[model samples]
Target chain A: MSNQKLFHVAVVGATGAVGEQIIRLLETRDFPIEKLTLLSSERSAGTKLTFKGNDITVKAATPDSFKGVDIALFSAGGGVSLELIPHAISHGAVCIDNTSAYRMDPDTPLVVPEVNIDRINEHKGVIANPNCSTIQMVAALKPLYDRYGISRIIVSTYQAVSGAGSRAIDEMLRQSKEILAGNTVEPQILPVGALPVKHQIAFNAIPQIDKFTENGFTYEEMKMINETKKILGDDSLEVTATCVRIPVVYGHSESVYVEMKQDFDLEEVKQLLADAPGIVLQDNPAEQQYPLAADAAGKLETFVGRVRRDLSNPRGLNMWIVSDNLLKGAAWNAVQIAEYIAIEQK
Target chain B: MSNQKLFHVAVVGATGAVGEQIIRLLETRDFPIEKLTLLSSERSAGTKLTFKGNDITVKAATPDSFKGVDIALFSAGGGVSLELIPHAISHGAVCIDNTSAYRMDPDTPLVVPEVNIDRINEHKGVIANPNCSTIQMVAALKPLYDRYGISRIIVSTYQAVSGAGSRAIDEMLRQSKEILAGNTVEPQILPVGALPVKHQIAFNAIPQIDKFTENGFTYEEMKMINETKKILGDDSLEVTATCVRIPVVYGHSESVYVEMKQDFDLEEVKQLLADAPGIVLQDNPAEQQYPLAADAAGKLETFVGRVRRDLSNPRGLNMWIVSDNLLKGAAWNAVQIAEYIAIEQK
Candidate 1:
């Protein structure tokens, strides 16, 4: 091997759904990792998971876990990140968080590599990844925004179950089987929020993704609205979102209607999207081709299809965007930030 | 019993999903029915069903099926309606069609009973029921349109599999089980358009509902756009729709964003919607109470919830509308028309 610097990487929440994806991606991608530290909560501390064909035991993520860590990727809950991120920073480790703990914070730059990779340089010690639904939309819409100057966005999402965690995936699958067998089921962990009420997610759609805020918007919707403006570095853009969770296991699909400040030709807009980075255009209606969540389950790139000019408005455009919520939405975005940091260090 | 003038009613496609609902509604409602004639295609001609504890055999629908029929409810395919509606009209039967064959006809009134019952008198032998997705939206928005005057509507639907037909319901159920069991499934009946491509509706969402027109909007989407303007009687109203089929078995849900011509008070708007006939208000965020598809199934009223004013636009509002696709969306709408006809005849 060439003599290149291999940095020590610490992965917190290594056993969770997105954390698992981060570990798998790190093992598969060409990253310079000298030591791989898999850290989790106390419940899953002793679990053994293999990475790069070597068995690694998950350790409890204490403040000292990042003693020699060069870059730490955090996918744990917000409370864990809040308590431990400062400690990791004190130990001279850069934190790339996938949770909503510090996304809207002015100090922590929210990064979507496809949309705003340059924002990584502005991070003091932590760079937050945007929400799963927001990541795909911004990534797909960045090209359009750069070309025609977006004014407003109205998006309705068809989110998957995996965004809730692995437990939610289990809950959806179990509830589906029970419903299919004519057996009743009690929902335990859906519409994950501060409330006690839980709605059924089997063969149904839940409109509220997170808890409702004071202004009658869900926390998840607010995250999309706020983080989109932050990531695009435009505070004046008008954005509205209706975040919905469907029974799909992995990908999140959005029906986005955007209004542009300047006029746009439909053919030129399609060409712009086709030439954009990290976007795959799939909009042939005659062949029944469009971006589907099932087809985008394991893929890293965002899929954009059903692109058409809005019938009523001259400058409005409609599109359907799909991507694996875990990979591109969370893990891969964090890893891409970490890779950028690694390359800068070299 | 009150002596009401009983009319002979014929239900074409009686064995189909919507046709079955119409028969049941006729049995339970106070409609004056002297004779009930069940008609279907040749394949299902001999099937027997019960109405008011009396057995009726399904007859093959033809020109003579409406010989003595005072009002005929047609839910058969569009081809059947296009071919046989003229014969029914020639036989002096006032046809209330549930198919799209006569929906866009200038002479045929596209009716959502709550929104356009007064237009029933203008029908020239055939009154067309609006699309299932359109029926719920217009019924929910009629009050707002009457109060503040709607200028534009942008809607995204989470439609049910039942909108496709009974066979689609079976396919969704079967594929859901196969998917839960980790077996591969071949989709056959979903995205029920002219195209040969089929998508798995078990845990996925299909963006295309009906066949796409030349402009890339699906027929279902176009139906929502065109039918909204027609049913509202405002050709100047701007409307757009993205119809998507999810895994729900019944009850279509829509995330609707509308721009009103006049300003609206949120509390007064809620009061107006709550006081509106044939509309249910279910918007309480604190208790996690909202209109759910599972709860809306088999209900007659359209449920409106999550009503809020848009943060950016002064005249914009966002709401969630849901209803049983088979009830208010189809059979009940037709039956409501037929009941008006009976009242007028009396």
Candidate 2:
């Protein structure tokens, strides 16, 4: 134990969903920490949370909150990350952001540890975590891409309501109850974006996950397309995505079809996926076993199944990918990078 | 109105979800029905349903039930269809079967009215309605396929609970209430297939919709693949599908990507869809206008939106297609065929 060097860590947005998960993971993983500071917005600063049998009072995050902090995790929102990430980096803290603020920034390496751990060394001060939907997809695709060159990708997402936030989870639960009780439901917080018109997601699927871009793709879909390319470090690869938010509370499921540049053996592809870093292969169809959103609620690994070669395109492969949006998608991913940095420091 | 010929119509599975919708559409459309007979299994027999301000008793469907029946709509289980359809045909009743029993039969013409209405003439005895998932997809793709010549198609579905039947609807509603009340839910009816395993549909997505084939695709997915080919009368076209069941009570939403053999003009494709029959284009992304399951529920028209050309494959196009699974997908389509047959006879 004495050979391990402990570091001071600060968790921003410490009261939010992904932030709370990050704190829980830090405690459960027994990360080497000499001191832990929990930080949130002014509205939630005074709240207390127990970690390692100690009550830690969360403080309002500001530029000074990063003083002497070796690692800072940001997950409040994109705006908060843009405001506080620079301050944390200036204070000599390596920031692992869970927001999209710096994911596309060429300087801040977008790391999914299993896919691109070496890229962490190129991060100047910040390492951005990919979107929850993008993280699970690239993790499953990385091994396949390495084995057989991927030329194009098309994905359709069945995303959990929790990806919007805790409020959206509450909204879905509330709406479901209201509809079941024969009462009218007024939707308040789904499709979280700049749009004023809210759609009911209690028992429905909404195609727009985020605000629409100049092209027809929503911001969430664009994030998957761009973040995947950045993490894979190839801008020329073709990617298209349709992001839809379902009533699921925890896990995000994706139906991904990829066209490989070369023909490959199906058995080899299955073996490669079975041996991938943070992936669990659950592709037995006869027993009716596959990765489902319910079974993937709290797990940290990406669960992939239903792998088959496309009937039409011999070079195309299709698979279903599922993972907990808060874990592998956000919290655990950030922690993995932090662990890498700690090991490199030793 | 007097010049129109009246016919005796029999509705099988009259107590089920799609059966109820067929009766409602018949009443609303004021179809020329001289006598209406509601037929169900022995379990649902003696139940009474009102049509055109007249109460009709649902009787046990047998060989004698089709006596003097000019047109019959069958939505019962596949076993019942296989047993009763031959008897209905022998009695001179044109059967429009909504089950999968005879959809792939060489003599049975699979018909989606808007796409292949002329095929009704070639039906030897029964006209098979495509699967609920296949109906909406082919309806949206017909115009595009006609103009650009489709080479391949890949689709992922967000299906409704009601497609599994009325019991599945009750199960989903009950599960949602139990889950919202923080109680344990015992799922009994989702992914209704030969498998005994049931999955929770409340706030979760089940990737398997039907019994898995030897090739790892479910029967529902294979229906989408084979039905598209037969309905289009082109066996060489490539198609693949992933069918997922959500908690939605009505309406099935599809994320479809089609690779056209020829280059397409995006504006021209939009115009083609807009000008097509039984298709509604709601694709203004600037206003967050897109087809949603909630909006498409209980509507007869196939709602299409989010039409965009793929960024990676110039010849590939992506669109979101949605329709009430019981309406345009089943009941309304069957009724449309019946109306065409009546007109052709006159």
Candidate 3:
């Protein structure tokens, strides 16, 4: 450990939810960091956060903030990533972005470490982390994709409010208390905070996650659809998603139906998932054990359960996948990539 | 209205959630009833409920309770319905059972009035109401099924706790309050109340809605799969469902993917749904309008939205369906069947 090469790392959006988790993971995982820089928006600047028993003050991120930084992790937002990534790259720092800004860019390899870590070398300067909903799904299904080729995926997400950010989580808790007190709720944030219409997320399900795209699907749904194909390196893969926001604070649970090209044994499929990297299989019908969002919260591993063959399609499979949207979905995924880059440099 | 013939009506499980809704519907719809008899389990018997301006006491249901019942609506548990329905029928009462007791019985007809009202006449003695999750979905898709001939369906449900009975609803409310207060919750009623293993329903998603069946599917999932085929009268049609329980109170939301036998024009599909008997189309993406479970609560009509064409399969269509589980999913569906039987007898 003493002889390992150390590097300077900068965490953009350091005070945000995912950013805070990233900082904690870096400290707990004992990453080879010689120095750390924290960056956020001007509103969140000057916030002091503890890292490895040392206090680091967050500064407003700008084009010049990446100077002498060997690696930069960006999770502020798509707009901030789009603006600052080029500057970070120009300073000879590799940027691992946790935003949608560069994920669809052909040169920026959309990498889920467990699924396609080799693709990390193909990145010119930026390695894109897939959407939170897509990360847990691809990680859980990578083994199945290797054994029996996947043709199509139809997913319906029960996403947490934290995926929309911290304010949405606060709104859900507040609205819940208000409803319990028999008071009428005036929802100010939910479904899409940017959108004018706000639906109650307390004791209800909102089918929209991000703003609606031109095709009737939300941006969140398209991210899962497009990013899954890219991360798996399957241009011909058929992926469709219905992303919904439930009142949960942390974990995102997905109901996925995948049609495989080859017939596979159900027991062997379960075995493969149980043995997969970064996946925990909790499927046991007799004991009533299955992956649940409340249990998956704060966990780094993607949990897979409810594995069964579709009665309609002989080669089709159905499974429930759950993971903390902030951890495995966003922060942990980016850190996993960062760890790979750290080892590669050594 | 005065010329219509009146009949003696009996409500089994009158103290239950769906049974209470049935009583309200019978009063509000002004069904031609000369008398209303409310029946419940011995535990809930003698509870006084109001109907029109009068107070009626619920009685413990026995075989003799249905002696003069012209039409009986049953919303009790499956075991109670199985034991009492035959007695009701022997007393010359036409029974509409909301339990799963007779839904798949060869001699009984499973009716979703808008989809298959004609089959109600073929009932030997009891007409079975489809499961709550299945009811809203088929009601929304019936028009599309008729126009384009659906060949297959894949559905994932976001169901409310009330479908489990009033106790499950109370558990969710209690758990939510506990969670908001930052106290640990001891869940005793969700996922399945009878199952030994309990899961927290407060701000979480439970993939298992009922006890696991032999096929690795919950009974609720099986109900959706089998009941759809029975109601649509299509043995060749393929349907698969993954039923989940979220922390909602009254409405159930379904994300459905259906493949039509014929190629469909998207606009025509929307129009067909808008013109359907008991469905409301709430799909205007530009204005951020869509059906939400919060808005669908207490409504008799099923709300359909997020309608789009599948990018992979040209004939495939995707939709979101929501409805009050106690109304269109149960009580009202039974009442619709009862109305038909009453007119037939007259």
Candidate 4:
């Protein structure tokens, strides 16, 4: 602790799609890093990456690997998180898990920093990053919820293929070329990669983002529905999600419908969102301006646009939210949670 | 009919995205034709188009140009249809308008053949083509509405930019290349062209499509909300629409949350969708296969997947609906209705 300043950050799943973005974001945001340890599965171990001119070799991630880490950020699959998070906690590492493994765990704190920074202090060594689609949504909704007291939420997501993983992104590129060349291409990863059914995502929309749970909601949909309630800290809030995957490589966009507890004006609602943390107001209708994935692809801001009242429900508002699924949705979200932990422990 | 003979159809929007495909569909379906008359805006007029080994010259569309034309199919634009439709209808011809200008006119029949083919007979002069987003949705819901009365429909569309026009498709391609090359590109011609706002659609999602109306709904969203109610002939059915423009070029996918008058069994709903005309079932979760835009891009079928009952609401069902926006949503729908008009009148 003598002159060895700043936090020692360990990034698991370092070679993954979101993991790579997390690396870039860390560099761009100038996250405090005393020692950066990169880790991945055994198959991906030994990969070399240069971060801030330091070549860091990816080590095989084992439970014991987290020994001296101060903060562990994870974008690995839920399986990896379920296995390694305890290792992280045991080694005194505050784990920010960017997977569904502990998102709904009653014992764990699911967080979007701008919305629920206070909740991070209650974390018992583990903080859950929400579904990529859910993160941007809650980031945008928190300000509205704080001011308007949202009674219910209904969101339909336009997600990208990269959220499925690196292989899915590759498959999208491969199939897109094949379709352009007028060649027959087999779909490998999409909707869910491990599922027996495959689908083309090069120039199309896929209505399902994750595997369906027995309760009839796809795991992705449930993540948004449950995470919204958790992040917003309103368990009684009525939330529903219909998640769909589009061909974009990054950014998860959502059409979020909300019912407020009190009457409000559209101008006031826009003002609240504009002032909200992590939110960028792109809602000037006269200019035909709003958020789009292409614009939000590399950015960290959650874009909100097309704010208006619901015709059927006067108290309800509908908005379009778009953010880079890899950044704001996954990697950046995990990093922010880690930062939140740091800020709170201070 | 004078000679008791049908005229060959020349699709003017040919060689263009919708035009090229309409040509292929017309040939595949074997639409009755004795001679084809291809017409386009002056910029594209006089271009030689090949159809079934026949070279057709695309003449400039004019009000005096519909002479002897029995059926004129249009998907060019509102201006083209507005200028040429009266001429077509006045000269013993039927015009199928695939534009916004005539859709809300009380006299025009907004026809989705599967849903309201009979309405074609009531056309005073022209038949209106519904929005690409509206067409597939109403087609899928029609069968359900027929089997069990629908009470409400809350649809959030993940639409492709190809619906905005050829220039938008070009812009998406242009913007993607620029982003991949690490260049910042500005957006133009999305949400609404007339509005001051234009956004990058390359890797983004824009919630505002079309202009805002008096009630806060964009023209695109209002089209879906209004058109759905009108097509279903049920003013009482609650409909809320949030239309978004994504980077996709061909398909318009929807995350439709529907409330029915009766509770439905999962298997029974599958059977109904299977039996429904023009609808394809792709909802096998075990295989991870479902309807996707890339797969639906070149195909002329509406796909339904992720069929599941809402856990909390007994009457609510959440499903994914996807189809090529160019085909079932716009161009092909117009052509199909035109074919039906040719046949049913005989």
For residues A202-287, write the lDDT of model 4, one tens digit per residue: 66676677777877678888888777888887888888888877777777778888889999888999999899888999876665
Evaluate candidate 1 by giving its C-alpha RMSD to the native, one decimal: 1.0
Error of 3 at B137 (Å): 1.1
DockQ-superior candidate, 2 or 3: 3
TM-score of each: 0.99, 0.98, 0.99, 0.90
Cα miss at B30, model 3 (Å)?
Answer: 0.6
| CAPRI category for model 3 | high
Q: Evaluate model 4 with DockQ and give the value.
A: 0.54
- The per-residue C-alpha lDDT of model 3 at residue A273 equals 97
Deviating ranges (above 4 Å) for candidate 2: none
**Tens-digit per-residue lDDT, A1-346, candidate 2:** 5789999999999999999999999999999999999999999999999899999999999988999999999999999999998899999999999999999997999999999998999988899999999999999999999989999999999999999989999899889888887898888877764578788999999999988888788889999999999999999999999999998999999999999999989889999999999999999887778899989998999999999888778998989999999999999999999999989886
Question: How well is each residue in B28-65 modelled by candidate 4, as lDDT tens digits?
Answer: 87777787787888898878977788888888777777
Q: Name the Cα RMSD for model 4.
A: 3.3
The number of the candidate with the highest lDDT is 3
| Tens-place lDDT digits, model 3, residues A130-192 | 899999999998999999999999999999999989999999999999999999999998877
TM-score of 3: 0.99
True contacts kept of each: 0.70, 0.77, 0.83, 0.66
How many clashes would you count in candidate 3?
0
The candidates, ranked best first by DockQ, are: 3, 1, 2, 4
Q: Chain A TM-score of each model, in the order shown?
A: 0.99, 0.99, 0.99, 0.96
